[model samples]
Target chain A: MASFDRHRNRRDNRVDTLSDTAIEGKDPDFDAWLSQQLQFHEPYLDNDGFCEQVMEQLPAPSRRSERRAARFQYGAVVAASAIVAWQFPFDRVWMEALQQSISLYSLVGVGILSSLAAMTGGILAARR
Target chain B: MDLNDGDLIRRVVDGDQRAYAQLVRRYQSQLRFSLRQLCDGDRGLADDMAQEAFIKAYKALPAFRGDARFSTWLYRIAYNLVMSHKRKKAPDVDQEAVDRARSEESVEEAQQLGMARDLDSAMKELSEAQRQAVHLCMQRGFSHEEAASIMKLPLGTVKSHVNRARAKLQTLLQAWREEVVSGQL
Candidate 1:
């Protein structure tokens, strides 16, 4: 907490310094030059039809309902998967299959596949 | 009376397409221009990033608490989008080369080109955080607090970035300042 406070105090000091530099006429010529340069770049962009393009790409106003439905669908999938996993011996079956195919090549293949799956899952989760 | 940003936001939250349109129209040019500067004048990539930012803003509108100004929030979304895009691409060799080239351009050489171009080149020479700080506070009229929120940095960090950016730009554009004093710029 002390560290956080120290950080906050430092930031406050910097903010004060920035305001002084910009607003207190400390360097009026540079401030004026910056403002003028900014203004000169202001009229370069023409946003013709840009808003329309954004609006057109937007999902319809039924986004709330769509999102709700998506949540419901996700919940259903999770519930169904949980039920099947609880009722089935899928894990035992997979272990037995792995035992049956217990060879150097098979183990190496499984290791590679597991690594790939983990990597893919990590990437997808990171994106989300 | 003109509808303020909050009112437009409220209407959009209530699913008013026209209100959202008004909000988009109000900010698109500024957002695009800022994104262009961030992307180092890559107009196409900037426009795409701006469009993606607006769409994300629309989707996230219901969660907006209005603690910050709408413009600040919009800029925050844009900044995040650009940052995420940069993360996905990973190695930005080209941008580094461009930055190196711009930094190499002397004040006198930039002055010979023109003040506006010189300013733009000098801006590209700043570190990313400094550039965003200057762009938001100096160019886009965001307060330091607002810029801090938009840049998702500590307030002090934003302030330091602004101060450092200003100092660097002041040094880089000193020649241009002399021209301005002479009424040549």
Candidate 2:
């Protein structure tokens, strides 16, 4: 069968060298055979549930890690709140002291300068 | 702007999980269908390859620069995975078994005009690429040019492959026809 197969392959390669007349002679049978090739596709397979099954096999996303993340976030919020409470006494009281010592005109000028500075910084950041 | 696939790709790159799932749902069927040809009706392997392809695509999404169609890039990835799979488990693809399966289906679709049972055995004998070329033409109804694009081959190369495959199939069918004519089949 191996020898026969090799011989068959040789004959098939020789087909390219055939004259136009011989090629034309082979055309009708070839066309009929080509039509038969089209027949194999007639009964298309349905893969309806295929996607669902594939999606099912996907490694589930790490829920345990998500829970850990949530817990860490909650802890950070609590820690931040406690720090703020410890520092809260100075936040308002210091502002009152500054307001009392600084003149109204200087305070207004400082406030305007701060606003201009913030606007310039925002524009630079927006350009990027 | 009508959301481009590139936009969806950007969102997926930005860690939008829902956007990634939308991409999956959009392409799953076509990818599965292309892979079904490679797997030889082993739906499980096809599914595995498809999911693996998408996951790999997700991992590599950051590098996608949006020059080509997203589906085209995804197809290239899928074909690579399918090729690697074939290398690993080089399938024997029992022709007789495939023919039996086709014949069983043909019995039900006997009323159709071109539902000839004889082509099943002939088709089963084709090489994987040859079978793929034929399926892309007949089943997917892709023109020779469209198939070339989908298969990522030069148009002339695709034409030659399809022509040679068709010729081989024709020879087998001719023999089958002779057997039938002689009342020997």
Of the true interface contacts, each candidate retains a share of: 0.34, 0.05
Can you give the lDDT of residue B176 in candidate 1? 61
Query: Model 1's CAPRI class?
Result: incorrect
Instruction: For each of the candidates, give the backbone clash count.
Output: 1, 0
Give per-residue CA lDDT, model 2, range A7-115, as digits (tens).
3454555445544444333565655445545644554435566445544554544566346544555565556556755875755655875878966677667756965
What TM-score, over all chains together, does every model reach? 0.62, 0.47
- Give a tens-digit lDDT track for model 1, residues A1-67: 2323343344444533544545333685676669778767665567677888999999887768546
- Taken over the whole model, the C-alpha lDDT of each candidate is 0.73, 0.62
TM-score of chain A of 1: 0.30
- Cα displacement (angstroms), candidate 1, residue B154, comes to 1.6
What are the per-model C-alpha RMSD values against the true structure? Answer: 21.8, 14.0
Model 1 Cα shift for residue A17 (angstroms): 19
Predicted complex 2: DockQ: 0.06
